[model samples]
Target chain A: MNKKFLLLLFSLLALLVLALTPFIGMEKIPFDTILNFDSSNIHSDIFWRIRVPRILIAFISGSALAISGMAFQAMFRNALATPFTLGVSSGAAFGAALYVKIGFIFSLLGISGQTLFAFAGALVSIMLVYILSKVKKGFPVGTMLLAGVAINFFFSSFILFIQFISDFTNSFRIIRWLMGGFEVIGYSDIYNVIPFIIIGTIIIILLSTELNLLTLGEDVAVSRGVSLSKVKNILFFATSLMVSGVISVVGPIGFVGMMVPHISRLIIGADHRYLVLLNIIFGGAFLVLCDTLSRILIAPAEIPVGVITALLGGPFFIWLLIKSSNNNSI
Target chain B: MSKILFNIENLSFSISKKEILKSLSLKIYEGDYLSIIGPNGGGKTTLIKCLIKIYQSPVNKIFFKEQPIEKIPQKKLASQISYVPQINETNFPFTAKEFLMLARYPHLSRFSSVTAADTKAVASAFDITNTTNLANRFMNTLSGGEKQMIFIAAAFAQGGEVILLDEPATFLDPKHEHNVYQILKTIHQETNKTIVTVTHNINSAILNSNRIALIKNGKLDFYGNSVDITKNNILEKAYNKKFTFIKHPASEKSIIVPEVV
Candidate 1:
């Protein structure tokens, strides 16, 4: 098959899955809810207020994580590099844990204190990493990774400390959120995030040319006229914003960001223009399917979507390692 | 009668008190084929990096066509001088055509897509480097020599008068090494490009470059026409070892051979 045609077919299939996901849930949203809207439209209420927003959030947040993952992988030139590799997710988790443990009653713009704190934590961790990298003459990748690992350890210990002191209910809440969930969200909750995700993803797509050159190496990219520092800084902030926004709301979903980009690369190759778009489509569908499975697997008892992804993603990751080791293509 | 294209004057670079380049000065003409050769860790690669402004130089020290190099925007400078990096493996598997298209970046605007003329340039670059068949192949799947040729083709697509190459044939077999040099020679003669390459391959440099720049201890110990290189004992000084030159049977270029005990 032609590569373009194959990509299109895959995208359509993913879209079909995404579209069909809302109707297959526990309540079985009436298929005619879209075409009929009377005053006492219970089906319309379920479809519009709950199912639609849940799927939209799932698709948006999933794509956000995946797109950011692809960008970070190129930035660090490491396959394992994800948006969370630099401790962004850990930092957010710590903040959310702190908020829950402290029982913070404050809310900004009807947004919970936990979400606000999570965003701040993610940004602060990235800022710390940025500052650490600036101590060197060039922003060396190895140094940044080491610093990120250090910060990740630091935040994880703090989160554990918070968990130790919290009451049983608060600690349980914190643990469940950390495990990741896509629930109880409406369009108003994500209205602001939509703009940031759209803008960030679009900007990354436009700079796909530079992203392609960067995979060759920093020096090669610079020699090709890419302002290395400018591109790096822009991508860092954009990726941080996107990742932080999703983690703040959806609570740090894992595996989708790291695994989806690699899967897309294996399927479509590593050109970011195509990779980014395909990831948005395919990655969105991937999490919707996972979320659907999470809801339906236990039937009225929901497992965290994050756990479902890990359960599936773990074997895929191991297979990738074995295949690469056997053939050494990676 | 070629005009000076690059002028380096009293330039120096250091990292944490460790000097990589001293107060070295040299003039490169518009269409000169210059080779920079030195022993390992003698700053040959560093000099190439400095020339391309990867290591920032003083405002007036490095001039491009009599204008301060720092004044040129990165995009404009790239269009004037493209670089071919040493053959290295890439984990990302971009096709050769997609990889080559990145060379057209400096000519492109932020939001615009690649156009028909850009495709023509890429096609012509493939023709020059004899890499048309490899266009659709994944970059990581190609052999080292093939990858090197594709990079050179990318440089040609960059539309630069000056092409800086860093060890273009370091890890290739003899046949591929000769093939790479032949492609470079054609680019130099036919396209009228100023070629400056850093190489440990003394014979290849001597055969392909019109002039040689010998670097030692972060300074240029010799810079002259290739024919004039044999008139001095600079090679021994540059390497801190004894050397002798032999004539190539066909090209008649001097080949440097080390004295082994």
Candidate 2:
């Protein structure tokens, strides 16, 4: 089949899945109430206020994580690298834990204090990784990966320390928040995250050619007329914002970033020009499917969406490892 | 009599307190095909890197077209010179055409796709390098000789005035080694481009280049025409060995026969 045609088919399938997901929940929403288009219809309230926002949040977060993952992988030249590898999620978890421990029961402009602190923590860790990655020469991939793992462990220990000090209720809340899920009530949360997703995606897609050059290595990228520092700086800032933005709202969903890009690379090629858009579609659909399954698997008892993702992604990751080792592809 | 294309004066470089290039100076003119030959760890590759500013030479030391290299933007510099490293390996699978298309990067706009002119240049490069059949083949799957051909084709597609290569024929059989140099020789004879290559294969360098520069311990041990390079015991001093110089059987050119002990 023609590659473009295959892409179009996948895109339409994704759209269909996105459109059909809101109707298949635990409680039966009346079809007429959905079609009624009334201001106070209970069914319409469920559709718009509850289901649509949840679907939108899942799609947005999934797409953001996947795209950021692809960029991080290419930049670091590591197949296993993800947006959260540099302790972004752990930093956010630490911040959220600290917020809970401090007894701050405040909300600013509908944004919780935990979300703000989590984003701040993510930014700090990202800066540290960025600085450590820079040697006298340009960014070294090995050092970046090591520094990321180091920061990740460092922040994780602090998070454990925070949890140890917090009281039961605060600790419970913090733990629940860390197990990411999509329980967004209305359109406001979706609206808040959509802008960051759009801007970050656009900036990254525009530099897709440069990203392709980077896959050839840094010296080749420089010889090909790519401004290494400029491209790296932009990508770093963009991926940082996207990861921080989504994790703050969704509370650090795991493996969606790594799994989605690798799967998309299998279906599509490694050309970032095409890979970026395909990843967005596949990632969004993958999360929506996982989110839907999480809600419906045991009705009235919700599994954290993070658990579903890891459960699905873990096997696939193992299969990838075995396949690569078998074929000596890595 | 031609104007100088590249001028180096008092160039020096160091990595982690160890100097790799000393205050070496040389002048290369327009349309000069120069090959640099040296033993291992003699700063031959580092000299090429310094010439291309990959090692970040000092201010006002290295000049291209009589202008300080630091003053030129990366795109403009890439437009003037192209580099082919000794080992070119990409972890991801890119087709030969796709790999060559990157050569046109310095010439393309930020948002535009590959244009007709770019395609034409790539096609011409394939024809010139005899790599038309390898266009759709994955670069990683290719043999060393095929990959070297594609690399040279890509560098040609870069359309730069100076094409710098480091060990263009490394890791290849004798037939492919000669074939690689033959293709480079054709490019030099057919165009006004200045070609600079650093290689350990002294016979191949002598067969192709117009001028030769022999480096030893980060200094220029010898710099002259290839015909004049065979007279001194420079190779023996540079490599700490004995060499037997003989005339080529067919062309009567100077060729070195290493007297292996």
Candidate 3:
């Protein structure tokens, strides 16, 4: 198949999915009712107020995770890397859990305390990963990955400990947040996540060439005149900001990050120039589809979107592992 | 005498408090086909890295085109000198053309698209290295010889005046190894670009390079004409092994033969 044609077809398909998915769910919102602007119309209210914002949040969060995952994989030159690989999501979850335990109700500058704490926790985790990786001589990728996994375990245990000590109501709230969903009411979540996503996407696109070179090898990249440290720092900071922003809003959604980029790369080769954009479009559509399934699976009582992605993603991940081992390349 | 392209003044490099290159001073003249030869652990690769600023020497120690190496921006330095790294397995499945295009990084800005000149350079690189047929093939799928040719082609596409190759024929059959050297010789002769190669193939290095620098224990054991290598027991002293000199069948130049243990 022609690569450009394939890209265009997939892009159009993704757009179609994004366009059609907002009409699905427990509420039957007809096409005509979507055109009705009257506030009194319950169907219009549900379409505009509930479904649209939820889909937008899902699309944005998925796109952010997918692109960040793509960047991480290229940066580490490893296929298994994801947005949450460095425990940024776990760190943010811990922050939200701690906030719930403290019972903080204050909002700062129109942002909730939980979001702020989660962002802070994400930054803290990134800093710790950086410091830990620096303990080695040259910030080698193996050391960085091991450091990230260690930090991931460390934060996870802390989250578990916090959950253990909390009251039943708070414990339940923490568990619900950890499950990861898009139960957003309006465009507020959109506003909170859009800036980070936009900034991160732009940064990744700009450095797409460097990302391509880095994937070959660090020596090759440096020999080709890439400033390794500068590029790596920028990539880490951008991915952290983007991941933290989305995780703060939607809790720690998993598998979208790991799965979407891999799927995109499989369809399009590892040329990051096209891969990054494909990840955004396909990843967004994919999560919207998953979130729609979550909403309609049991009609009124919805399964968390995270559970659906994991259920699908786990098998896909194992299949990928097996395939990679067979070919000795991923 | 040709202008000096690179000048090293008492450059010393260390890693983890252990010195790897000890106060090495040398000058590389423009249009010089210089080969660096040494036994294992003799810092040949490290010297190439330092020349490209992959390993920074002490301040004011290494100079490129009379400017301090550290002061030169990496992109500018890259445009001036290109490197062909030792062969390693590439995991990514970049097509040969896509892989070669990455060599244009030093000449391109972030927003600049591929220009006509870039395309011409890449096409000419393929033409010169005779790898135009492999341009569409995935890099990982190519054999060692083909991959080495592609690496050389990438260096040509980079359009640097100087090409530094680290053991370009390390893991190839004799036919492929001879092909690599032939292409490099044609490139050096036709373009008059300075070529610095680090090679363990002592015979080929002596035959091809105009000058030879034999390093031993992080120091310059000998630096002189390639033919002069057979004089003064240089090979025996550097490798700590006895060698018998023999004349090449084609060119009648002196070549070394290792004595049986």
Could you give candidate 1's per-residue lDDT for residues B115-180 as a string of tens digits?
998899999999999999999998878888888899999999988889999999899999889988
Model 3 scores a C-alpha lDDT of: 0.86
Interface RMSD of 2: 2.6
Off by over 4 Å in 2: A37-40, A99-116, A136-147, A321-330
Of 2 and 3, the candidate ahead on DockQ is: 3
Question: TM-score of every model?
Answer: 0.92, 0.94, 0.95
For model 2, the docking class works out as medium
If both were scored by lDDT, which would come out higher, candidate 1 or candidate 3?
3
Give the number of colliding residue pairs in candidate 2.
0
Highest lDDT: which candidate? 3
Give the interface RMSD values of the models in order: 2.5, 2.6, 1.7
* DockQ of every predicted complex: 0.59, 0.53, 0.68
Model 1 CA lDDT for position A96: 73
Order the candidates by lDDT, highest first — what do you get?
A: 3, 2, 1
**Residue ranges of candidate 1 with Cα displaced over 4 Å:** A33-41, A99-116, A129-149, A165-169, A318-330, B247-254, B257-261
Fnat for candidate 1 (0 to 1):
0.67
Residue A108 lDDT (model 3) = 79
Instruction: Pull out the clashing pairs in model 1.
Output: none
> Chain B, TM-score, each prediction?
0.95, 0.96, 0.97
